[model samples]
Target: MANYTDWNQALIDYFIKGTPHGTKIYLSVDEDVIERIGYHFGQSSTNVIWVNDFCIAVRIKVIFEGQVNLQHLKGRDSQGLPKGVAFLCATILAASQMAQEEKTSETNYFKRLREILALDGFARPLGMKFGNEAEEPLWREWNRWLMEDRFLPSAQRGGGAATYINYPISQSLLRRTDKDRLRKLFQEKQWQAEWDAQTLFAHVRREAGAFGIHLKDLLTENKQRHEAIVEALHQVYEQWKAQGCPTADKNNYCTWSRHLFCGLYRTEEPFLGQVDYYLYPKQQRGRSLESVEVKQGDNLHLLREERPGWYFPLEYSVSQKELDNGAKYQISSPNDLDYLILPARDFWILIPDAENPDSGAYASWQAPSLGTEFILLCKQELVSDIERLRDEHLLKSSCTPQPIFNNSGWVELQQCMVVSQAWDGVFIKNQALKDALQPSVKLLISFSGGLRVPKIGAWLVNHGPQITIFGFYSTAELKVTRLSDNQIILESSQSTNTSIRLDFSDPGHYLIEATFAGESSQRLVKIVDWDELAIEKYVHPEVMAINSEYHIFGSVIGQIF
Candidate 1:
């Protein structure tokens, strides 16, 4: 294996091939210069063939590390100012100011690039403007944030520098599973105990944000983007391995993007749901009902007495028209009602868009459905509360069977059981599994007590959501082992077809190894405890609907939804 020094040397030697890389290296970890005779051993030294080059690298690290002194900008002696900081100040500089500032005055480095979104040109005018910087408030804000060291580099803070966000670093920072892989590759242990790799990473992130650079997002999205990308990559790699690992040098020149197999770790994403709702923004205007405008400073509050278990966070809009007595009032944004969205559930989330096969009321956001636009969101652990809400008559009338948004394209809303595991080392032990992964040769191992799979939480979390048996199949050896302890639970020397339903009495994460020819493919499997999984998966609880006119306060009664 190539040592850490070889890797770092390659990054610097190969990446800084052009002027663009030279200009951008300040934003890269490659600029962190350190010299040692024995790999990651030995004391740090600045000895270098080119003194100026070493100086440049040192300077790049300092600025991004957030120790930038604004006053130092004026003290630099003419070698084109600090390289990185200067470029940033230039991008946002007012043209008039740029012209007035002295060329030798310190200014260097462009902040991380921000994408310019071209708005509706058809609806508005476009024009060109010039200056030391455009009057972009966003840039100003980023400038301030990146210039500080207060920002932490942990998962909560954007994990990577703005320039490198989305590029490996931030991706690792966003995902818990990616951290160990990155740390191992970077030889991060050499970092000072206090100013450790993580701390320095935070420093880089802090400075990037202070500079008003747009940090790429990982959490803003309800569904993660990386999971799908990794999954697809794994599938491709498996197919390639099963086909004999063809290479371009062998006259193959086939298309393939190779990715290192990072070890898999359990990952559980929170299940959440959102639905549009209506409410009275202001305090109840009992009996003497009259419309009142919610002022700019008005605080919207939810009536707690109305629903005991459900807590309403102020989130909706009201309409101007009168509540036209209609059964399905939640669908239309009538001028008569206030509109709002229900908060998403943090855990056990059951989005109720239940349209009774018989209820005369029908209300929908966009999907074809009818009922009060109510979603039942409760902690998965809150079994009693979830049960009570499911049984509530008023809630049943509001929340109904509706379309749930799942960006992952997984078959249905899955329970938090069976968390996702990061990529693991896949050993192609069989010839068919090595370089000839037939899409038809999929090895599916399902769990069932006997031969029959239980519908109880088994189907949703343990197996059957994705059908891998698309191509012809060959006999492959199958082994199921308990991951928590590495105990071999079951083993079969030969299995035909693409699917095999294996019974697993115990619940937890497992490792399923399927071997074809001589190669074997392994991936993580999570078998959630039936008890815990049952709560997340729906168990058809009875709920009554109170479809009638309701009162707002003690004195006022109106057709409120």
Candidate 2:
């Protein structure tokens, strides 16, 4: 048998020497020759040869179940041929015979060979047929070796080389189970890691190539599937919105968009119930029975009984229009009213109207329960329909479901407000007092007399003037302190529309605290110096201007001094 060196030299002489660049040569050999070379020729295998600074691509085909009838080796016994030399002899004999055939006939004969070799690193095996049976497991194994064994460089290592054994997949060859497997494989995160959408699609396509499907066709089908899923989700959202967004429904809501009311709940399964109370802004009036306009400079004092009590004493005069519109006028002392509702912005203070009944009511108000509750009254069937759609369209399609907003599946309202006090409103609080006459309200803090710089979380003001802080819709006492020294700067006990003027002569940070009905909220105010300001200009050297004479010239750029 010829050794490796002798075989290599023989191949170089017969295939490479004097061959022109871009020339393609075909060699057909018997199965024994391929076995001798220790290479498996599927339908065809290709190798490259360099000649005179050019490449000659050689395609080798194995003639199975038939004798090649090579005229040059007619007298020789096939079994006696040397292992490596057999491949070289067969190649030379085939080339000499094919060179004399008509060029058009030769081209038509090797058209399938050209198609197989056109794909990168792809080769067709004798056992596999196009649009027919395919050895999918064998192809998948080769591809896995190419990827995991680093047969080609990895993209993660900054190499763009890709190699895969691909076959044309027909729809008839794909079983239902195979398609399901492909769907699950497409969603695998391991293959998707560090891969962009295009690269990921390519990888998936290569995997599908093992099963004989093309990337373009798969992408077209996937796009249609994705659109169907998005449409299904939209229909479910519209149905839920039309039904008043009930919180107690069995349907799972997803955070798909910001404008949807379900996004406010921020939970897949939100706690649903009915709100039993309403919040209304407190009515401010003068000492007289008529409504009064209380100004910032007014020194009016709100009178309350000095005895220990939760409800502050305030007089409410029924208007004549309200009485004429069938309003009830019930004459009852403080003892008859069982609950007193103090609807402040930050604090919805609920107290027993009776004089000092027990310590429980006082403890409930003073215990710092500052959470807001949201109750969604949803129709049960609407949510069930959404869940059904998700399972049918999303789950079966192998599309991952959107994650639950809160893992606990419970919705917590961060801020609450009361719409009106006259109507019986639903009050949902952290503590569920069935008879509790409280409404959810939010605090409003407005800052004026300064340039607000949101990026630095500070307010910029001149050194001499004071910045005014106003708490609107709040019956809260205002307190200001210098944070650096923790010194009290201002403290006022005004109830409605309280405004405090703070001098920011020095540049530093200050803390403003507002306490209303035992609930306090603190805000940080940063003082900064405003010495000088000017607009900056950037001039481009390439920019030219024309004078009145229509002469274009470069203009000099000047900087602000």
What is the clash count for each candidate, in the order shown? 80, 18
- For each candidate in turn, the TM-score is 0.21, 0.21
Q: Over all chains combined, what TM-score does candidate 1 have?
A: 0.21
Give the number of colliding residue pairs in candidate 1.
80
Provide the overall lDDT of each model, using Cα atoms, as 2-decimal numbers.
Answer: 0.27, 0.29
lDDT for predicted candidate 1 compared with the true structure:
0.27
Q: Candidate 2 lDDT, tens digit per residue, 478-520?
A: 7877756878877876554444456766666666656665444
Per-residue accuracy of model 1 over 224-278 as CA lDDT, tens digit each: 2322222322323332333344331222112222211110011112253333224
Best-performing candidate as measured by lDDT: 2
